[model samples]
Target: MMGFPQLSLVPLVGLQYLTHSSTLLSSPWPLASGLQQMGISQGDVVLLLLPNSIYYPIAFLGVLYLGAIVTSMNPLSSVAEIKKQIADTKACHAFTGPENADKLQALGIPAILVPENALSGSLKDIFSVFYKLIYSRCYLALRPVIKQRDTAAIMYSSGTTGVSKGVMITHRNFIATVAHFVRFEASQYEGSSLDNVYLAVLPLFHIYGLSLFVMGLLSLGSRVVVMKRFDVNEVIKAIDRYKVTHFPVVPPVLTALTKRANDSLAPHSLKSLKQVSCGAALLSMKTIEDFVQTFPHIDLIQGYGMTETTAVGTRGFNTEKLRKPSSIGLLAPNMQAKVVDWNTRSPLPPTSTGELWLHGPGIMKGYLNNAKATLSTIDEEGWLHTGDIVFFDEDGYLHLQDRLKDAIK
Candidate 1:
């Protein structure tokens, strides 16, 4: 799936901008050539600091196509946060909007301004850089050798405990995520994944969103409706307008949607929504109950994962014979887990509370440039000690109990 030319042969529609798969495949060549012209080669890092847009996926894929590492940051991040990440990653260049171009320039890093939307006749002058890059005739003559083990991205973990650290994810890790997590989930459904319409409200910088939107679903030829940010009304309208089938969101978004379902006079506003997946945080039983009651037709599920796991943990699935709203489903395929007593470091039996340890191909290489932290998080036995306390039930459903580490948001 490297470069993804073989997988994405269908059309992709984002925010009314319809781009052919061939254009998506070839658009990266000019960008990679441009980066090479700027003297950025394999192993160099490029920062992407922009909101969700069609360009986000192109830029992310382009960086990987060049064999350079990509490190994405929140577009709304503070100047201090941006500076720290840039310094930490040793980024050579950046792709961002005009609002943050000056900030990167002031730090002596070259920045490429990415437009918020596709350029039309009137907006042509306003988005010259983006317009020129995608249409440029330049082609990369020599492609670098990128091994599966080489780092493809450096996504920063949510600095819940302290300052955020970069998690190095390899190409092989992403392949596993697509296979075991994304495509596997799609396979459990009725139709082909390419027929499913996905709403991309989750930020592209997060591993959950990045894994599904930018890499996984794209590889399966799914249509992704990209939003600049989350807005409840816009989300409803988009789902109705585009017939969005699969929506991946966090608990707050789900809660907001549930509230909308309760207040909206038009019951069919979200008639097209087939499944809603919640992650990043736990959903209260009340929230789950309300959602299930309000939208009985839509499948509501919860998943558990972290940046260290490349977002490849358990995912909720409701079958005709079984439905456990509280559990985070079973472990993903090709993945292993163990619930260990935190104090004793001993594995616990079913229904016993303990910290969750995960082992899989999707596990990240390590925290970039932090060997000590990496050693503590991932043990010598290669199990990633996810600091969340959880347990599995008799039915093999994983349930979240509490967090062993302090985390913010």
Candidate 2:
């Protein structure tokens, strides 16, 4: 790790306007000190219910530095869902926005209320004073070291099928996915200033918006504009206001963007956008074509992956490739993929539809607190059973059919 670029230093590189909590700069020391004061320690699960507020980054990284596993819940989660997640993870402490703070506390769980105006005068002043003391020691020779396979975050999927299960994303898995994305950017945005602002309207709780897009962008030094929730009009307004260049979204968002273009609520100067990436759900060929026709100059690419696979397993969609828009491109570099029979686990030949199995560092450790589920998902050799039915073409491009789990018997 000596010569590797420090991911923490990336955001400070080229930022005319990067706005996170005042405490974001309080990392490596103030964070340690604050958590020490709060009594959070390694291996503890901390439930976080913060909005897209600046406080979110501060609280999240603070917990991470303490060796505690952070579980971020959807801000819009119902009271029942919130209660279930807290119980499931058995979190010792919680940090949340005012909206969900009292409700969570009512469950007899301890919590710290992140003030509505946490960025205001008094808090900002306090953070500034602490920031100076922490930085003065040059981080006081902080010897923080995170192991590659240590559990970093316990993420839960949307559970469209059933109760959400915690997905265990290790530091190694995340770093590998980051490495994969860096390889994908080889010539696409090469030599371009990473100072460009990124508009992030996607929910950070989701794998697509959280690990793949936000962390990846921050690791490379780009300003992030986070929207608390997805509002089609607000998203457009933010893009224009912030002059965002790269936009990452889901299918529903892509639809709204096309419908809202050139409208009064839409950004007047959205022509500044360089490219947009869509994931989380299958994007239709008509939607892709319509988007290209509407924006004309913008490059739109569809990426595919599941939470178990650490966000994106593949990314490849160019003009020639769009002839078969169903394909999610090729497996990412360092990723070895094969189609296997769902029943016998026997390897299937290419162009034969079967379950997609992935072997890569980006695959999760397993489902948290569920050994049976873990065994069902990850084999002895560490291949992840994606539960998604897909096949490879003669060109080696992967085309997804439907989810084996989602398919009705």
Candidate 3:
């Protein structure tokens, strides 16, 4: 609720084409309202399988307004994966584009077609523009106070290494994480006069990119360059063209960044770049040092969290505190963290190797449809048992050791 209320605060007025060509093609509110008009309400679930487009934001927010839950999904989900998630969530309706229409139908679920040509009208075009103006203004005036405990989004845990679980995160958890980002990082940025341009190469589907990079940056009014997919050359060119400052890199991209020479990675006159945040997985110390050496002007930071935690918990390299390479910085204010014995679930003293436990506003409500998994992950005391292995140093710096399950017995 910074500037545009529900919209990004980073000024996009100059980059109108970027948004118009994507999200503004059709009236997002009307389309979102159409779903409510069609009968989905709070607590109801809707499965969405649309391509990476402007409709994603529209659909997501619309679901939020109606108090309904959205399960943003990958179109490439195998029949088995799609069926499983849909059935597990007990989704009553689905809105999909032509690409996945047949797949949704195969599930015998009620589906709505979101066609590419749904917004092709000269009269409707004028009306669409007018609709955006009124809706945006109304969104500002009527910016509702989001309840911290209210479930905002139901995300499927990436089943990459195993079975996918649906994680239910409350609006408060996200806001709290954003509060940490603003207090820790964004406030420093806002003090500067230089324009902030963010290159959002991370998929919104991922927790790292979605809340931290997207919502975090946008809330501060930074202009975001959205790429449907992460192509090396394309991202490089955009940064050069836009003079993008922030690039949220994951471990794989961090590896690539360090592997390539500075000249090979150089974008068009990108002097605006000053920081890079690496998350999703651990960034090697070697990579961090190499990157800092290559781009001395850029501050490299690392963050750690999981989908269950709304990507909160810890991050590394606070300028005000002791910056350590292997450490994931200090816990954000208002959040309590403990190191607990893996087997006994009892709190361990600092410097002792144990599983990380987090209790914060950002802790997700629970895993949707998996009471057993939820109970296992979150104890009766309300602490979230992060499957991550870590140890806190005497100075309160959190150092990454290994994942709980990944650690050798």
Candidate 4:
């Protein structure tokens, strides 16, 4: 979809082995056919309640290919949370790990067990739904005509501010995200993007991870090394073993990496890493400095976005002439933003701290089934009101100050 020719090698590396892009892209067809056979149609909601695995991208694309909607949840979520989401979205089916299958089954939802890794041992049942779906020879015919505005996914907000709401993202939102978010960031650096290898430690369920690993980076044909979860030890080994150049992480992971870098006997394991992109949460100034000082050669960039915005907003960029480690850099291309005064609801000028509001194609369609919450977040003019209090400096760099929402006690 990103203009790379369908060929022998495309862009996924899993568990120390290379999986051809053609294989990854083509595997979804059978899955789409299977979903169609199971009465799944366009607009039907399917939940992906699993961790980062090679199969994740396949299942996600498969559901979309069939014109069905995808809603993902953290695999570690309690049954009550899972049941609530299922009810909210009316999810007809779910793809999850074998360990979590019973939870879905107990709720009267069919769960297709996906393996934790590329290895087949994890899926001991050769006749499992995942096995049958992926290996099926029947190809999908008469694919549903998907519109750009059609809802592609429903990602739940973190609920730090309040109760979690399903953020509805459209196909156009994802297309714009890949174009403005992933591709533009790749172009800023000097290298063939196809040569870039990313270490995927962030959970694919999160917008920060999903936008990059599952959708965006693949468009550029960048090789992604998938990890089921983040582990400093395994992350180091993967970077060395796979020659990973790009690492996308959250603040905690960055902090953990900085600490690991300080304590490791051989920091040479991370010599191949070229850049580390941090997001999901704000990074303390101290954390930013520690990472930059520890990995002097690696570019440490912080981004600002939310699930409501489909992870498109401002991104940190460092050049030879300009570098703002603490600032979240500039607004994304084609994205218009405003720093609005909370009390007056008026747009503030530069250097004034207020809530950040963003208007862009990447903004969510709305909170699914919650017109009241959607209207409150997005105004009549269409700017998605990000509750983060931030200010644009004189140089146009966005600096996050605080949040309007009460802190989670």
Structural similarity to truth (TM-score) of each candidate = 0.93, 0.84, 0.82, 0.93
lDDT of 4 by residue, 1-409 (tens): 2533121111233334455667687888899999999988999999999987777888999999899999999999999999999999999999998778889989999888887654456445833778789878888777799999999999999432477899999999989888899889888878788888888888899998999988888888878888777778878878887788889888889989889888873846788898888887788988988888988999888898888888899899988898888888889999999998888989898998888889998888989888989989898999888888899999899998777874212
What's the residue-level lDDT of 289 in candidate 1?
95
lDDT of candidate 1 vs native? 0.84
Per-residue lDDT tens digits of candidate 1, residues 94-201?
999989987887888888888766567866775676667778898776889999999999999852255579999999998988899988888788877767888888
**Candidate 3 similarity to native, TM-score:** 0.82
The lDDT-based order of candidates, best leading, equals 1, 4, 2, 3
Candidate 1 residue 132 C-alpha distance from true site, Å: 3.0
Q: Judge candidate 2 against the unseen true structure and give its global Cα lDDT, from 0 to 1.
A: 0.69
lDDT: which is higher, 3 or 4?
Answer: 4
- Residue 260 Cα positional deviation in candidate 2, in Å, after optimal superposition: 1.4
Error of 1 at 185 (Å): 0.7
* Number of backbone-clashing residue pairs for each candidate, in the order shown: 0, 0, 7, 1
lDDT (10s digit) by residue, model 2, range 248-342: 88889899888877354433568778778777778887888888778877777667777887875887556644444456776787888999887
Give every collision pair in model 4: 10-21
lDDT scores for all predictions?
0.84, 0.69, 0.67, 0.84
RMSD of candidate 3 to the truth, in angstroms, is 5.2
Off by over 4 Å in 4: 1-15, 120-127, 158-161, 406-409
Cα shift from native, residue 205, model 2 (Å): 1.7
